[model samples]
Target chain A: MAAVDHDRAAQVGAQPLDVKAIRSDFPILDVEVNGRRLVYLDSASSSQKPRQVLDAMTRYYETTHANVHRGVYAIAEEATRQFEEARAKLARLVNARSAREIVFTKNVTEAINLVAHSWGRRNLTAGDAVLLTEMEHHANLVPWLMLAEERGIELRYIRLTADGQLDLSDLDRLVDGVKLVGVTCMSNVLGTINPVAELAEAAHSAGALFLADAAQYVPHLATDIQQLGCDFLGFTGHKMLGPTGIGCLWAREDLLEEMPPFLGGGEMISDVRLDGFLPADVPWKFEAGTPPIAEAIGLGAAVDYLTGLGMDAVRRHEVELTSYALCKLAADHPDLVIYGPADPASRGGVISLALGDIHAHDLSQVLDTAGVCVRAGHHCAKPLMRHLGVTATARASFYVYNDESDVDALSEALAEARKFFG
Target chain B: MPGLEDLYREIILDHYRNPRNRGELECPPAHRYEGFNPLCGDEIVLYLDVRDEKVVDLKIAGQGCSISQSSASMMSSAVKGKTLDEARALLRAFKAMMSIHEARLDAEDRELGANGQGADGEEAPPMGDLEALQGVVKFPVRIKCATLAWNTLAQGLDGANGSAGPS
Candidate 1:
């Protein structure tokens, strides 16, 4: 199969990326969906776990089923080692300076909230503004909106260009008065990949903190927090072919030290007092409760799996798949109208479309009937939908496991539906 | 054996292709109702040209799936020339039939089943022309797809959010 440039996968000012063998790692692609062979294309929402990841979790629960950091028992020690090992894996995945900078949360949503509650509360003044984007997922958007309102800070959005790319013209304008710049690395709806490094540089130049919602980007790309120069990066394990209930936030060492702890508990406090109690250092201070130990272990396995396949390879595969999907959807289904960047060279692997006169929900049903699983709705980007002049879009987001044949099945099913309706 | 295919039979396809009563009421004083199914985001704009509480003509104009478009076409033809009370009763009957799939409709029993056209074959509820929508039951996700228009009609007659233009 010929590999071509994907719209979102084309990284400006970045090195060459690879893809292909990564698809072999995920075993769920061999299964069936709706009584037909599965083509898991919804990786933008959540990715399917590989056999290695699943086995790692099962091995943890089966062989080393014990609590971490507290138990004096041998199994407890093993659990603690494995848990820390997962942290080490995550730290390495993002090239963090230390594992201590990684605080495990439930998902990226919780991680963002941790920043908003503690960092925003500490840094924001009454008139300070937080710069965001209109294309941000609710997880990335709502937290800042709420925190801004509560702290008397104004929330400003950087609009997207007509082609769905970030409108960089207002970068200085929006970054000027803003104290924080929170943007998505990749859009779930439009598949527009933001240039995180450039945005981070702009944020720092303006003396504003930059945070990346790496949920949609991290799984496919090799992420380096130090290289990107981002102040903070948040992502979930589930979206990266790992277990749910495990997420991570990597904050700069100095930022983590300066910001107040998100939650205080036994693990997060070294000493307590009646009037004054000092919180423990960086990661511990943010993680207050018994985290998802098994999930963290599974995430370690997932990182290992992705690393084995290589992030470059994953990105390349997705680029090829998205490009193929765009061409197939256009050529095969003439009635279909794909949203976002017209060329696959401009967007992520997410293929969002409206098929003729069919409502997105109805199209989703018809596709489901033919065992083509896709997501249809406002996709949590309601404001973006209003901007796009459509109610909802049928999205088929590809990952490592999907291939050209999956796009064929999707195209065939869509054609069947259009013919049936017509 | 009349199956799901029969629901999407030639007649239903004909109605879907060339929908009847599909326009705005011309120079008329009548209430218009619009309904939307947010789950799938299907919208139906139903115009009721009423004369002294009687629906002299009912018009619907919108684009949606076959279920929605067909239902809109069905609703238009079903309610035309019917009194407000009769229309409401018919709507209530259709709603009941939609919710309770097993219980046969009195409408069907009075129309063809009792009139000696069909017997042993249980009469699928004649939800006016909406009987074609029975295939929607198999696809539970699309049940709302078929009911978008009827739900709007229900909201309008109940006197709520209607007569306003769609945002």
Candidate 2:
């Protein structure tokens, strides 16, 4: 599969993504679904892992499997070193100030929950507001909602514009008295890339902390905590070609030190007496139990993979593919109603669409027969779905391995679906 | 490996295209029940008018995929003037056709099982147009969509019967 166009790469001025080589790395991309080649477009839900990531985990378990942090044995110390190395890799990936700023979590959901439970409960009280956005995934929204329920705090949202971008017109009013403002760096469904740095500036000017939900952004874009100017950021491993059960929460060290521990268990406490226990230092205090050690190692490998193929190159490839898809879908299927920003430069690689009178589930079902995997339904953003005036949208999200051929296949399948339904 | 044709049979597509008993009935005499397939966000809103053990009329209003909407349409047409007992029998027959009971069977037994039997140990009533949805059983994720309307009807019937004093 000579998928990358070298001629076009020259025009872009960035090193072209060797999509053929990248696809070879992911074993599942070669799999056939329904006697057709699999076209995985559901990376936003969870990305397919590369052999490197899988091999890294397998190698860890086979050679250096042991409980981390507590054990003084040889393998255990090696395991601890590897785990901390993974943390350092993640810290470097996002350009955090120190490795101590990175806290390992089950996934992005657990990371946000940690903040809501530990930092939120301590800082927030009744009548205090936490501002969020309309396009937030439930992972970012639910934790704050739960906090609101428990502490009687108010929740406000930065509304979405007609074009699907965050409507910052009301930011001044919305962020007025809020203790913290949380927003997704990119929308999972709409593919809207938000202006995190600007929002972070607004949040700070209003004397509020800002948290960026980078579950979608970190994998597709070049990210920097300093550039984003966020107080806290959360992202998952699975969406970045890493194994599941591992995520990261990178918070400013000072803020982390001030907050109490989220989950009270081993590996998080300095000393446990019958009366009470003293919590450990910043990062470890938030990591409660024997962590997902091998998963962290795999995530480290994923970071290494992404870094080797520069993030800038990956972003350029996605933008180009997204532009092609948008044009192809529009030209071929005029009835197709696409959701999100019209410009490919303004969004990530996710494309959510609705065809005339066809429900998203039915569309997805038809796409499945052609071996194109897409996500259907509310996408766990029912509030955003309601805002879009739709029950659901079929979303096809691209990743590093996807190319123009996949988009062509998607268009062909969509045409088949329309004819079949008619 | 059932083909798309099996799941989207002509009869099912017909009902989906021209749904029967769509829209709401006035509520003073009608009982409303809603069913939701939270997995896919498919909603079924059913309005039932029951009088003297008979379902006089019913209407359905909701949004979903072909399986759900067509199933709801067929259900409305099938049970418009039937007795509550007859409607329940049809519901049981349709669910059996969908292999609802087989889902609960232990894995080993399920592999060897024939068609699911109704609770009464009697033969299931003939499932007329509802048989078109039999293909849904192969697509397990869509079973909820095919049964959403029937389940809502059951709820409406139960609520109507329960609200009316002992007959």
Candidate 3:
């Protein structure tokens, strides 16, 4: 199961990941920029796609390209089979109960908006509440805000502790009237790996539904919806070495069945009468119009590639690398202020840093000149930035393909940038 | 290395470390406007006090990167006592210099010398210390940081003119 217990994996003593072979699979690592080898540390923004995923997409377009589900011809049947097979792959990766529970959208943002519109609009009323956290990305926050504005619902927030973890001391009071609790399984900016199971339990005890934004979590960790026990999970493919324009939203079968269709269009409809129309079945009801067919197949190939390497090994590698980075950065750059948990075990590989008196923009530019790509901005979480008392920070995230050498390059670049600025 | 040195010249850092013409001018008479670089969240507020068609005073207040803050500081000094038309001309010259062509700028710098005066006494370059920002053209992303103040000043000048023709 993707969401297998972490304690179990730790007990077994996870093996070191083979990053040398993994780097061979991603051709972009070979490119040079600004007379230096590309040291891509911006995986949190988007991971580079591997050859397997790219080949799958190209193969689909080259041979098996057709409009799925509608045509009964040979090529059409093949296309539909490939598309549904990809859905099943995703379901397996996330330990979803069935492929029918998965709704494909443009990206995680659209998936969240789908749930907010289809379920939130139907279930929520004035004076009802939606509970979110301070660390949620704009994708998770804005949709619920829009719904609240239109439906006159109240919105509550779970605050963050000084150390960047969620402060849940007041959870019982905050969840009193909340109809739904939407939160990120991992903080994209802070790199805090939230306890999704605990949150789900809290939401369930309060008689509320829980939606986990797994955009950052699913890529770096093994995820199982059943074990996590969340009612809804949304994640994007691009952040996990798959192509862009494809994302997944998994919901419990019964909840999806009861929800109204999100968009009125060709694929999501069973019958169209001038007076009224019949919506399609559970997953298709949310998937409107022609979908990203090739991209979906690419995502399936990405799942296969990740599964081949094993998610447990991947997580172990990231944890080890993150620990190394935290130590290396702190020892070398004492003046740098790092955001998020001090203990690497409580976070993913994402690390956001505020260097002494230097703007994140300038730091990123200096890093770029040395071919070290790092993201420097609000990271789409302006509220979190405000909470941290800073406008922006330089973030360098790692992935399965990244090793300690990458961290060394990042540290070296930071030293160079500091000297250059001074 | 040479490119970096050109972009972060000592004078620009001096202005960034010690800005000039910063703070508020008594308004109701002083026209003010604000601008922001949405890409990087850089902001600038420009203040212009015009008396008899000339910019009698200029001030800036904002926080941003070295490029933006230093550019604003230099811009305030450059246009403090110029006429509205001359200030707009300086803005145009600054923007033109910030545009592409790094090699040409280097050549222009060598040909015109440090004083920015042509050997043949044609016309002095409009931008003074603001010319140090010409190296910003190398970085496509930082161009907005260098131009936030000028754009705000332009808007302030427009407001000042529209109200009572520089009262």
Candidate 4:
């Protein structure tokens, strides 16, 4: 896969990403930890929210705080509009044909579970397979595994290559009896950005529905459901600089309409006559009970913020920083084993490193004292860790707010950790 | 003080670099159990040999962070050649040091003097080299890493009391 060349894209129509100005938008970046300036490098776990997103949620709570659909009052109607408008904004962000196709859930985990339990249980039968890559997070893998166990279907895995990319050499055989092709758009560990459109095409040609776990991809890159041609794209709001407890599952409207409600409760039903209940419309049918109203509004604002900054600029900044980090880290620590593509062009800003004889937790702890926040674990992808022949790696993921200085802090902290551990 | 230097004490690092009694014990008269932190994928497989209600031999084998591996190493040395009851007491003392359940530090304060010193009071027993892990208390998250081997050994002792398979 070729590097995206997002720098060119940013230069074309978008203003150059001003990281210093962007840093000001996130207040938490100013915090101090262990008497050291905070250098947050854990965006893959969750991105920090900007004041725009925070203010939007607070404003919604302060002014318009009422339940939707059932209440016919003025505030209720206002709340309903804001909530639906949030859906429209999210739909627009992903280029979904209709807002009705977007289903709000707790997080990407729930979104994937919604599709697996609601659509999967109904459509898939015994002997059918859900093809997944080895690099899938537990959020994408466990839900499908549960479905496979209950429905008596096969769960096949696509092998990973030596360089940490998905080895699609046996695509024909792997997709033979597979009903669903579930894969991550980008590896949280390896930082390998996958060819989502190409994979979706392969799934379609093999008569399987493609579900791309865009939890990692949607935050760092520009997402277009139409361009990707995926049947379903699951992403969390928190990873995109919005609050937790909100995520979007964008599926084809017809598919959502055909699928039954995942959870049976209020707002999801149109008429309940003691014996049987009629489900609500497409997206609402999936979102049962009290929805994450404020969270959705906040997510809408987050989408707006990203749009204002331009995703191409965000990507360009990340690519430049990642390239610099790769070079800087390589030059500084010759013994350090950084995973994923050596070329920052081939990967996102996530850099997973294994220093010689130094445990990731130790590195993380040492770095923590230096006020460098990094993820030091299997990153919810144990199989991928095993594939990489490592117990864990200290992961540093970049976002819109992260700058070159943050990477320098991480590097310096890593050096300190190495020396201290030795 | 709750410092990184205190947490990664020289004694802890020594044990981590050269873990004591790290290998598999023969199956006969040996009870093996595995412990996993799961959060960081730190695993410890404890092999215990009990004879006449005493742990005559013990070995720890697995891969993990320095804290876990060092704790396991220290645990093997701390418990080896001790009666099951004595080992349990040491385990209790270690857990108390970690203040597992957020228990009052009064008891730990009495045991560990102001600056990683030994007990001044008679009621609190000095935890010795285990006192090096007193710094681990500041890092609540790494407490699990420091306790994996001891917990696994505890489970293995229970298995010995119940099944004692192939003995």
Candidate 5:
């Protein structure tokens, strides 16, 4: 597999990286949950920050706690440098051509909102459609919905195959009248990784702009915006073992220039007057207020931590862990109904399931009692729940810190929940 | 202290496995109200037939955890045949009991608390076998599960009375 992308592997991972040593870098994994050793399997929701990321954030707040690009003072200069350096680091992680393409925002939700308001509202009109899939997170779904309603644009949905793959057969039909396509690179609930490159090609062939929500995929695998061939991409820092308050929107430099500014505020402007004020270019036009400074620095450090471990290795580790978990779950707990594909390679590390005679919430509670923390809900993907023919499901997601032992613990706890409830 | 075994008592499991009033209500004099607990994805629809200001009949149907479904079954029996105001009182008493362990409703104020807010938005818990759900308050995540049925009941009354918006 490494030979398949030998050039990429040569640039990124010629030297073998020790993931166990990298796991040691994250101190939060050493804590206890309800008297049980912490097995943090909820990285799909939000990852645990490593020691370096935490220390970087704390060090910034302690020493360089000043406003960025202001005051003409040494402290402000240092803060601005730290902030821009973080942008540069994010650019490297996403394989962006320039740091100017990275617009710091609150989270992936805010980043998507910027595009919906600035790009979609202005370019889209009545009869124009925005093609999306059934697999999108609500954050990606609702903004387009609001924009479509406001702009009188049609919202078209691409369906999903029974095997949980994207129903790309009708992509051409769905994008016939579409102006833009907003899709998820990976479904958080189903854990299916969509082929972003091919989807972007389809979307472009239909003459539509594409925005890929990289929230779930960016955390586990390496991302190259250029290779993905999407005009815009959005992701949150929290899900990638960074601090919570920061995220990025990576748009093609030309596309950012073409779209108008989303919000108006102090820093986004080159100059302001009562008459005809002009907004700053590219990333600055989108970033409207005081950007999350220390958090961005932490995200930069988190990217450093991930890069040090090598994302391919991390991807391989999660594949092995989730595959082992799925087999153990089906083999031991015959009553458990694990949703999505049986093959680990077909999905990411997320495992959604239901215990016999027990609702997902009850299953979650039983797991929690044994200190096996997992998510129990519709996961903000209610449409997917309906598609799966169930009310809700319990999900356990794995990351670099996760191993076979953690899956073993979840397996034991799940059997216990079923027996106690059954 | 006895682990999940303490939470999933035999009676609770029995009620979950074979729920009472488990199907959707037929369209008849009954008005329906659906309540959702977004956190746990538990949902319940309470159907009510009100006549002469009394609950002539009641049934609940939904998919949820044992705490939610069992609590709904208990509510159907407790609120049936009770006056609308009396049913309201039961809900207030039950909610209070679940939220505050030691809260005891006074005979006279129970009706007042149910019809309107108590002090500081702290109305008494709804009354009935719903009180068995008091154990859910100990688990913050399950609190929504236990309240799914009661909230739906409040909504059904709101639809009947036309002021059920807040519930």
Candidate 6:
């Protein structure tokens, strides 16, 4: 599919998205919530799957349903081909060095856990520091914390500035002796995009590996893993218009070859002797049990759908939408406090805001009445939540399907919430 | 499918706006217990003063949604002067009310041969303003918020009784 026209986009910093056409692909978008049109602003949590993805999974099940890599039958071979084909599509999506570098896990949480268990256990020891940022989702932080507790490894964090961007001023000092640096490319709560390339450079200069938690990045922006220069990257499918139960971890092929297998099971083993077992090759070694075959096929279809929409266009639409939302909320509700970089260009579509003295849960409840779906609470970033001096924030995130009207709806709902609570 | 009015009753909002017994009590005389709704980061700290087998006084210290905050406020007012046995009875009644829909859900799931138990029958005691929170039953996700303070209070009472020995 051709990319969105860049010449027109350059003039306004964004191409106008075909939002009506995009909304038509998602059947759930047509459903009414609370007798109102569903204004889905929770894509940052998990994106709504399109008909393309759903139909792809249904088609695969109807014709190609069989266990992969084990059976020699025709249907089994066809299933294996489709499964591996999905891996190649995912690899192309992120511009990974090779398809072998992509290891399928349950979700981003499992992907991070794979690294913490395999690479972390082999390399980290007592007092060996693994640096991370404070704005990471619990998916990124907890795995390292668990490794730190078990292996006596020290964990360090890159601080967040008052405006919610990562404070990399102390990067040189913090990464001095770190063995690995794990950072999110985007803050799931604050919508602040971190300088991944620069952080990767600092980690490499300090003889440490860098891992990019791209759960929020890959779904919204055009991702080029080579440009990002991270040794390991993790992201989930569910948050990227794909099915749940599938995620990808793209590591350098050499690194995956060196790291031990994450889980011990049938598919991951080459031969299971009475005394010991030989692990399978890199990607397959990481995938132990029966994979989510349908989910993988659905994810491939999701990739095709996004590639057709063009990630640049997707990013542009969100940037424009985010800017509109910021201005609209600020002009309408002076009491609304938005967390993250003030400039919309410096962030993704996530907009976490707090109204005057109102709890996030209460605000979200009121918004639900208006059929505006926003996520409320810590947003899996409790430490960042503490740093912001707020217990929780009602977050309304945008995607390709969202537009200025959605922002207007959110503004109107906020007004209702204020009147209801005030 | 229930409306906002079902989840946020006027009485609940009033309790949230002007929370009764909102603060911390002295630790020496008060037994403290904390509860957390990990799902939403809602925390409730209960400071209970149980003396001579009665809830002599109590205070709440924490922040959360209206359901949790107001539920905690009403809970403080309800059990402030009640005997330990009476307070336990109220806790049982309140929990039963809150779990009514959850129990029905479990029953439905069980009919599909899922692993779930049916709701046990329990007589409900008279609950005054606390009844306003019955609306929370319609919103399953917020039920934990409504019950946070009560759970914390139960823990504090259990600790007090354990420390006081057969009180």
On residues A281-312, what C-alpha lDDT tens digit does candidate 1 reach at each position?
77888889787899999999999988876776
Of 2 and 3, the candidate ranking higher by DockQ: 2
Ranking by lDDT: 2, 6, 3, 4, 5, 1
Q: Which candidate leads the pack in lDDT?
A: 2
Of the candidates numbered 2 and 5, which has the greater TM-score value? 2
Q: Alpha carbon lDDT of residue B22, candidate 5?
A: 62
lDDT of 4 by residue, A211-271 (tens): 9999998888777888888999999999999999999899999999899899999989888
Candidate 6, residue B81: CA error in Å?
1.6
Instruction: State the TM-score for model 3.
Output: 0.92
Q: Give the per-residue lDDT of model 3 (tens digit) for A1-422.
A: 22337635833766777899899999999999888999999999999999999999999999989999899898899999999999999999999989998999888999899999999989999999999999999999999899888999999999999999999999999988689999998999999988889888889999999999999998888888988989999999999999999999999999999999988888999899999999989789888899999999999999999888887778888888999999999999999899999987778899999889899998998888889999998899988988998877899999998999999999999998899876
Candidate 3 residues lying further than 4 Å off, grouped into runs, are A1-4, A7-13, B26-32, B51-53, B98-125, B165-167
Flag regions of model 5 displaced more than 4 Å: A1-19, B1-6, B100-128, B162-167
- Each candidate's DockQ: 0.26, 0.78, 0.38, 0.68, 0.62, 0.69
The CAPRI class of candidate 2 is: medium
Task: Please write out the lDDT profile of model 5 over residues B1-167, one tens digit for every residue.
Answer: 44555556566666667777666656677787888888766788888888777888877876777888888887787888988777776776666656543244454454555555553345444454454565666666566666678778987776666633332
List the global CA lDDT of all models.
Answer: 0.77, 0.90, 0.87, 0.87, 0.80, 0.89
lDDT of 6 at B141: 82
**On residues B1-167, what C-alpha lDDT tens digit does candidate 2 reach at each position?**
77899899999999999999999999979988899988788999999999988899999998999999999999998998998878877876776677664453345433443355445545566778888898998898888889899889889878877977786
lDDT: worst 10-residue window of model 3 chain B: B113-122
Over 4 Å off, model 2: A1-13, B100-117
Model 2 chain A: ten consecutive residues of lowest lDDT: A1-10
Q: Write the per-residue lDDT of candidate 5 for residues A13-102, one digit (tens) a residue.
A: 545446578679889778777788887778899988889999999999999879886769888999999999999989998899999999
| Candidate 1 per-residue lDDT over residues B69-116, each given as its tens digit | 777787778877877666766665565446544244456655545433
Q: Deviation in angstroms for B113 in model 1?
A: 22
Report, to 2 decimal places, the DockQ of model 1: 0.26
